[model samples]
Target chain A: MAPFAGYDMPISYPTGAVEEHNICRRGVGLFDIDHMGQLIVSGPDADAFVSHTVSGAVLDMKDGDARYSLLLDDKGLVLDDLFVYRLPGRWWIVVNASNLETDVEWFTLRAREWKGTVKVEDVSEATYMIAVQGPRALELLDLMGTPKASSCPRFTSGEIVIQGTKNLFGRTGYTGEDGGELFFPAQDALGLWEGFIKAGETHGIEVKAIGLAARDSLRFEAGMPLHGHEISPSINALEAGFKWACDFSKPDFVGKKALEAIAAAGVSRKLVGIEITGGVPREGYDVVSPSGEKIGTCVAGMFCPTTKKYAANAFVEPQFARPGTEVAVMAHGKPKSGVVVKRPLYLPAYRR
Target chain B: MKIDSAARYQASHEFARKDGTVFVIGISDHAQEALGDIVFVELPEVGKTFAKGQSFGVVESVKAASDLYMPISGTVTAVNDALGGDPALVNRDCYGLGWIAKVEATKAGEFEGLLDAAAYEKEAGKD
Candidate 1:
């Protein structure tokens, strides 16, 4: 166990971390996303408030729809990456687990700037989140009384009534699997978790309690970025491959001018995927050219069990962004060979 | 499943058995379990001198890397090269074939501060 934000998180079970990681990839696994913070932005200026605070176009979204977005600082550096879903009469924003307090403060201060009536309320303590991911995730969920096996659009959500509890369910996940993120009343979480595990047993689905350790490795394998690692207050959204999220065409938003300049000049450094051999490539490992010239730095990395290789994502000089660009990772005080590739190291086997 | 109550331990988890000037040094069973599956072990070269608690080498497990510290001030007299290929021996036989390095203690009083097997068993039992 390791200390993370005052909680004792298990890095690996006695069985092994490698096995735990593969279990999530090949079969269904349940994750306790209860640590993540949720907030409700409501009132007359709800749409306008979210539009101004986030990089995405939340103002244009209708109820029951979700959009991927980023919370940017005044200079347009990312403070947090989030998903905001428009609910009936309110907008629900899901912020990163470790950045709950910081995100709440960021949103609260911005809500005060709205010219119209808007109230930002933190509902994280009153709600709970559970992520069920894998190829059979929907099937097991169907057995639990979730309606419809049909696929929902990538960033959309649907409300479901399960076990007499109303759950706001979204067809989204970070594990690169066919799964859903469900938010329900906090009092119903333990019962819901037990029910899922018991029902998943006979279907040959494995139930494991995923912690931050496996979460990091699985997200790395799926090419998903974490807040502090890949996106930070000092990094721009364009260089981090979040350009699609920013809509400059819309009316004025935060840091639009800086982002326009970045897009026009082209990014000097770009985030690229790299596969390493000889040793594990961890965060902050120096990326160098064959001649030993430093070219970049690893933002996140892990030993990917599916491919049986060590992989990393680095923000390298633009000259090295193309696939097949050769680079060396300085590991254990030695140079190890690696090559830049596209993200999504493990292609999902899901039918979707 | 059994622990030798007479063996002594250092805070670094290395166990030392003193017989005159020579001391047999290996990691304790608790250390092996805490490290999980050991993948590689790097040992110090023979004739290297170290004060008590000096890091002698590194042990890489599948999950993490740990540094092996000397239990007592000593001069390295022999090294265990077999561990380079089969580091799992440390998990299987930490007190026997898993012995990492042998040393001739320069400070005989250093072993006095180490915990005997009974004391270590009590320490391990607490958690």
Candidate 2:
């Protein structure tokens, strides 16, 4: 186990990260993602409060629907990327583990400034989240007798009962594959994990216990953004390639004016995909032009198991952001040749 | 993981075996296990020379990249070119086909400083 956001998280099983990653692509993989935070917002003013605070269209979401959104500071810099689920009567917000406390505090302080009644509760301690991802994920879920797991559409959620315990789940995941994230009480975590393992065996599916290392590689290959790596307070949503999440048509929202201005003036830098030929380019490595002049820095990089090559995402000048542009990444103190590719180095295999 | 009985070991987990005047060098089984899956290996040229304890090559796994050190000062005689295409050979068979390089030892007493299998097993056991 390795330390991740104060949790003793598994980095990989004995099969190693590569095998686990391959299993997720070919079969099924399970993850213990209890470190993520769960926040509940409810009251008379909850809808308006949520819609105004986040960059996504929150109020338009129907019950059992979820949307990817972002919270931004006053200057339009992203504070955290999150998923907002419209439950029966409350809004369920799932934020990154490291930014949980800060996000809760921000929501509480903002609630006080609003005119109507709004209550925000931090329910992270009482929640346990498990992710089942990959091509055969739904088949395993169906074999386990999880109701609605097979029929639920993407970005939708439903409640289910497993082992006589009530649980909630959403057809969402960080891996660009088909999956569902199960949420239940903390006390039932062990039973649910073992139950899934047994169910997988009964159905002849190769369901392996995945770790954070493989989780990162899988998500990286799918072109998903990590909290600290891709989306951060230093980067705005537009430059981070999340302009779609920012609803400019909304009348009033935090960072709306600034985002509109940025959209009009156009962004100077853009996040782009890079394929390195020589060595692996890790986070914070410098991206240079053909003549070896530094242009930007790599925000996230790794040896993509699916692509079988080193790839990365970096924010570079607009001219260098186009696909097929020649660039170089500094790895091990030497510049390695690469090309700027399109976002999502691999096409998503999501069952939408 | 098995430690070769005929090979000499370094504290950093490299093994050197004498065949005539040339020493076949590779990382130990314990080192390969610790690194997980081997993805890439950067080997020295066939004729490169290095001082004792100098970094001679690189071995990268999914988790990290580490510098492979020389056990003794010598001139490289041969490199296992097969590792360039399939670096996982080090993880699958670290003692035999996974041999990284063969070096012509520069001095006669260079093998005297390395530890035997029993001593290395004890040394590796502590971690």
Candidate 3:
């Protein structure tokens, strides 16, 4: 166990991160993600308030639908990347645990300024979250009495009952595999954790307890960005290639004007994929040009278990952003030659 | 984790035990367990010399990379090349197959200063 975001969380099980990562890729894996933050945004002005607060089209989403979104500061810098769910009569926003307090403050301040019946409530302490992810994830979940979670398409959220209690179920996950996330009262954490483990054994299904270590690699292999690394207050959508999550055509939002102005003038930096030739690249490593001048920084990098290559994400000058551009990353105290590659390193399994 | 009675241990988890005329050194089982899954180990070249507490190499786990410190001042005679292909041997048998290096000790007196198995276990237990 390790301390993360003020919570004592499991980093991995005894089987190790490599096996746990393979289990999620080839078989099944379970994640205890209770540390994530869940918030409730409700009242008469919810529809407009949500659309105004987030960059995604939350107003158009049908009840029980969810979509990826982001919160930006007034200067168009990323505050946090989040998932916004349109449930019954409220907006459910799930965010990174590290940014939970900041998000609540941002939303509460905005709601008060916009002033209506809209309400913001932090329900994270009262709830537990877990993810069942892998190629065979759905098959194992189907055995439960919960009716047809498979029927819902990806990114849909609804309700399912386990042990006679209703649980919030979403066909959403952080890993690039096909899977679902479950949300319930904190008291149900242990029973559900054991129940899934038992089911995996009883049915001869392959299941592994995935921790934060494997979770990071799983997302890294899929070429997804973690907030504090790839997208943070210092890194914006314009530089991170995350403009797809922003809707410039939509009406006035917090950062809409600033993003439009920045996009028109063009961005100075670009986030590109780098493959180290002789070693693993790591976050904060200096990305140097062939002439030995620093041009950029490595956002994240490691030995991708699935790819068997040392891959990294870097923010570099636009001239060096093209595929096949040669560069070097300072790894383990030495500069290792590398080249820019076409992204993403790997796509989500569903797309394949 | 069991401490090898034949070896003397540094508080940082490295162990040194007399082999024929040299000392064999490696990290303790408790160190491997705390490091989780190790993916790569940067081994120093043969014949490299270091002070009693200098950094010898680096151990890269799935989570982070940590430096391996020299348990006693010596000239490295051999390195466990097997770690290049399988670093998890350290986690499996830290004291045996995972022995990191064979060093010709220049300061044999430092070995006597390190904690013995019973003493090391008592110190590690406090963690």
Candidate 1 lDDT over A145-243, as tens digits, reads 556523556568887777887888888888878778889999999998888888878777776666666777787777778988889987889889888
TM-score of each: 0.80, 0.96, 0.91
- In lDDT terms, which candidate is top? 2
DockQ for each candidate?
0.15, 0.61, 0.50
lDDT of 3 by residue, B1-127 (tens): 8789999999889999999999999999888888877777878889989999899988877778888899999999999999877887998899999989999999999999999999999888887
TM-score for candidate 1: 0.80
- Candidate number with greatest TM-score: 2
lDDT score, candidate 2:
0.89
For model 3, residues A195-267, the per-residue Cα lDDT tens digits are 8888889998898899888898889878777988889988877788878888777887778888888899998
Instruction: Sort all candidates by DockQ, best to worst.
Output: 2, 3, 1
Model 3 segments more than 4 A misplaced: A277-280, B106-115
Show model 2 residue runs off by greater than 4 Å. Answer: none
**Models sorted by TM-score, best on top:** 2, 3, 1
Colliding residue pairs in candidate 2: none
lDDT scores in order: 0.81, 0.89, 0.88
Report clash pairs, candidate 1. Answer: none
Candidate 2 TM-score, true structure as reference: 0.96
